[model samples]
Target: MGISKPSRRGFQICCGVTVILLIILATVFTILAFTVFKPKEPEITVYPQGLENITFGFEGFLNATANATIAMIVGINNRNYGSFKFKNTTGFINYRGDVVAEVPIQQSFVPARGKVNISTYANFMVDRLISNTTFWADVLAGSVNFTSVTTVRGKATVFKILKLHASVPSICDISIFIKSQSIETSCKTKLKL
Candidate 1:
């Protein structure tokens, strides 16, 4: 049997309508991706609470040692249209450019346009702070300064299709007052996508 002319015409019309509809949908999605669904850098804040179990004295004849626990809270604010999922990472606490403590960060996730706060405790210990000549001067001044550095590695997934790898680096400068047993902190962060 041979196909009729009217049926062939109807089939061609249906295919043409489908192609036009697909083109329109593609254009709409492309526009939205470039405008509404664009990615942005997340904001980070660091708050240092105080020092716990702080003890500093001479271990032996002319040997000085120190031990304490640093309590801090870290906040992550996600402003993007996607969720950020990060892996486990380690943070460093530096005194005069020397690493003196390690902070361990567990893997976690931050929802889109949401915020999360992480509470961390890092043990601060140094066997020979007296070896550094400036250590005594800093103690006599009643306050000591330290720097904290951390990097979070993650992937942001938008609409379950677009995946962007991101690295967020945070740096915090902290000052601890010995007499008042107080802490002050300032932090800055950078995002790499």
Candidate 2:
């Protein structure tokens, strides 16, 4: 078929417009894919805990039989634009390089750009610690020092595009004064989420 000059020009124009529109759509899709698939980790903070609220009881005045219960609180800050689904969190209280108490975290969910408070209890017996020499020395000094390690496991989900898993650990020092019924604590938590 013999083509007219104006018809040929119109066909060229339509081809050029279609090619430009296709390139624009491809670029927009690429940008959106990168933005939606980026990964981020959640953050956790353990409050400086003074164990004053921890209850201590002894079965025998001179015996090594002691029972204790502790209340611990922590704050989780979710900075990402997603929800965090935390798994079973646990905290271990260590004294003289031994675990004295085990705490289970109560709360589980952290919303996007939100903060949450989690409370846990550690109740344990001192049967193994009674016969220890350093334990009595620390008790006689009227102050006993302890360490707590907490671990949190979770996954962050965003817009059905990204899901990143994270593990967070925290450490804190605890001191209890027998005579004053008081407690002092220092916490340094570097979350590697």
Candidate 3:
């Protein structure tokens, strides 16, 4: 059957309106769904507080062994999960702005939780060499500053100092204790200085 031109025009208009309404409904539903179920943004902090509280230790003592000399041992322990890196580690041994001697800490790689020890000795020929031993102690006990960078996994550095003093005619012994987040699997020594 032949349809009237006016009826065909009406049908076309209704179809267009229906399509437009469908598009508008779809857009509104999408926006609502996102607002109701979207996840929140995450917050991350790079540097945390209490890092300044980190500190290092130092100790020294006089020994009157057969050689009548002075011996001192100092060490830094890793107490964190990650290994620490000390920049300019060799220059840490200084006394009142005066440079003395520096020895490298022999630690291959301090593991997630371990400690490393380093020691140095100065021997004098005389039995009553008070100045030499005292001078070394003063130098060793002073504050030592170094860049302690922690590992990405979680590591920290801890230090302890032990000093012993004895008469030049008697033998003296010194010990240092250290605790840290990381530990080393093997002992490693530096070749120079």
Candidate 4:
């Protein structure tokens, strides 16, 4: 009787549909698992070291500068990322270190942690007049106390420039002001030295 054709048409159609549905379901589940169960990559956040203040003897500065400079000390709290083009670090000093003006350190260096005490002329303002008045005010007032200046990045020693020569007081009298906040800080340290 033609073996009744065994209802090949209906059975074949059902089998085809089942196979297709299984494939679709598998694809969907694979996509979901990849998106949801995959592990995420780790991220790192480097907390910058705080150089709050500094105080170095004039003799040390003289040796560091390699040139005759005023007798003064200086300090600062800043982020000297690296020996970049003087635009990344955010520290300041009363004395005219290597950087005459406020600059930013734009480079990266090793030892992503700890302090440095290298001496450089990048923060010296050079020979200038020393005044009795607070130097920060003059800086805030926009007085050009120096022709050029450089901001230095040192190791363990932080030089603080409090006052210039008390004798003539016209060689290099200066003061500095700085304020920077940390990652979790609400109030910043406003220093005057």
Candidate 5:
């Protein structure tokens, strides 16, 4: 059997219409991806009330060491059009490039164009600080300095079609004042997609 001329013409017309519609849909998606659905770096902020339950001890009034729990409230602002779902991670507290403590971050999600605050605490040991030669000098100055790094890894889903892996890392410098029981902190955050 042979195909008829009218049926062939109708099939061609349908194919042409389907192709045109597909091209239009592709263009619209491309434009939206470049403008509205674009990814943005998340903002991270660390509050000032940093450390708590501080305790110091001296061995025979000569050897001094300290232990404390670092309590911090971290805020995350998502500026993207999609939600971020992050996994559980660990944050590090470093003194002179040596890690002294670890903070556990629970898995969480941030809505599109929304904000979330997380409270995390970790026990800090002063062994590395005391081992440093400048420890006593800093103690005499009544302030101690430390650095903390926290990285959140997640996936961003857009329109249930596009999924991109993202990593947001926040670094902070902290200074603890012994007498005043206060903390000074400065932070910087970056996002990688």
Candidate 6:
């Protein structure tokens, strides 16, 4: 008796149908990967920063423990089609190589394709700002430059459903001309998951 080849296949999906199914699955997977797993970066810009209510220290050391409130203007742009919900965010202000001030970004939800502005402020000591040799030299030279950095650690929701977690770092360079009361700002952002 010969094994009747076991009817190689009873009922099977047609080759064309199988190919179509495979294509559909592949397309769906690709879309999901790009939208759910891919990391998206939001754009950030720091407007001009101003030194307000600045007061130098007491008698002997004027620059020591200077009391001053610094105000920094920040703008965030969410370009993704999904909303970004950030929490426990923080901002850092650095002069030369040292962090002169820090602030916490209020927990909020950034809508998709939306922009939001924030005015961040922190009290920093001129003693710390002048601590950096470069900053000190610049101060003596009459030109001061600082950096404003804002970081948002949160999850991105695509189509209001898929949530992927990541951290977004936004940095801006600040040039302050104390003599002229002029300020210049430029910014850049990076996304890291």
Give TM-scores for every candidate, taking all chains together and pairing residue i with residue i: 0.71, 0.61, 0.24, 0.22, 0.73, 0.75
lDDT tens readout by residue for model 3, 1-193: 9879999999999999999999999999798646742322211111111111222233445543323223334344433333343332322223333333333333343433455444533332233222344644633664222121111121122232221121101111212212322212121221110
| Candidate 5: tens digits of C-alpha lDDT, residues 98-140 | 8887788899999889999998887688666678787789878
Q: Give the 10-residue window scoring lowest on summed lDDT in candidate 5.
A: 43-52
Tell me the TM-score of model 3: 0.24
lDDT of 4 at 174: 31
- Ranking under lDDT, best-scoring first? 1, 5, 6, 2, 3, 4
TM-score of 1: 0.71
In candidate 6, position 68 carries an lDDT of 79
Provide C-alpha RMSD values for all models, in order.
4.0, 6.0, 20.5, 18.2, 3.9, 4.4
Cα lDDT of all candidates, in order?
Answer: 0.84, 0.72, 0.33, 0.32, 0.84, 0.75
TM-score of 6: 0.75
- Consecutive 10-residue window with the lowest summed lDDT within model 2: 46-55
Clash pairs detected, candidate 6: none
Q: Encode model 4's per-residue lDDT on 108-164: one tens digit a residue.
A: 322222333322222333332233344557556645333222232322212232221
Model 2 ranges with Cα > 4 A deviation: 1-66, 79-82, 190-193
TM-score order of candidates, top first: 6, 5, 1, 2, 3, 4
Clashing pairs in 2: none
Put down candidate 2 lDDT per residue, 1-193, tens digits, no spaces: 8889999999999999999999999998789656853434445555534343434556577654556665666777776677778788678888888888787885498887788988766655566555557998998999988888887777767775777786666777888898997877666644354
